[model samples]
Target: MKFPRRRRDPVEVNLTPLIDVVFLLLIFFMVSTTFETRQALELELPESAAGTALEASPVTLVVTERGRYRLGERELGAAELGEALSAEADQARLHGLVVEADARAVHADVVRALDQAGALGVRQVRIATRETQATSTQAETP
Candidate 1:
């Protein structure tokens, strides 16, 4: 007597789940990633409610916490600072010069940057500052 053989089923991989997982991962990364415009120098700008928005982008002079001066991305000494300011003088006077000093930076450093700008004939010099937090003030009844 002859025995009958059973046929085996063909193997198949479902790609729908794999594609779904890939899309999920893509979405997760897009949502979780932070997009921040980071500058060459990190600064905690002082807060002020009196700051006015500029009409044009101007040359920014950054003063670090250690009283170091940074013109754009280039760090400069006191001697080199004058040359750098002079180089930017035309643009500084045309658009303006913004002094972005760290909150912890020495006041003398900031003033020195201003003096340099003034000496270079930069008339419009604005200090960079973040907006101050609004405070609630309730009138007291006597």
Candidate 2:
């Protein structure tokens, strides 16, 4: 008995699902990307009506309510604060300095940090503050 041979059809890849997956990934990435960038710090920053986010990452100096200083994650003594800031200022690509002070922090402590930054010749210094809520019933005419 002789057996009959059957011709095979050409193999084809369907790209509709692949194209759908690529578009879904593109949409996910676009939705997940953050446009406004700022370093996170654990502090109850004072509220203001005119606080804006910083575009460039600046050297962050956090001043606690108890007059302690933290610079980019390093805790320093009052004397060491100046030294650390000076070293940061010496860096070739130092963008700027940001002072994040607790709302209840002593005024002098924040001023002292500012004084140190100024003494180190840091030109661009920004004080961080949270945005004030607009629910205030009392309006001040300016």
Best-performing candidate as measured by lDDT: 1
How would you encode candidate 2's per-residue C-alpha lDDT over 22-134 as one tens digit per residue? Answer: 99999999999976332554579899887777764558888988898988668887889988888788651367787889999999999999999888888778888989877
lDDT of each: 0.85, 0.83
lDDT of 1 by residue, 66-112 (tens): 88888766788777889999998999999998888999999988888
Q: Measured by TM-score, how close is model 1 to the native structure?
A: 0.65
Lowest summed lDDT over 10 consecutive residues: which window, candidate 2?
34-43
lDDT of residue 10 for candidate 1: 92
Clash pairs, model 2 backbone: none
Clash pairs of candidate 1? none
TM-scores for every candidate against the unseen true structure: 0.65, 0.63
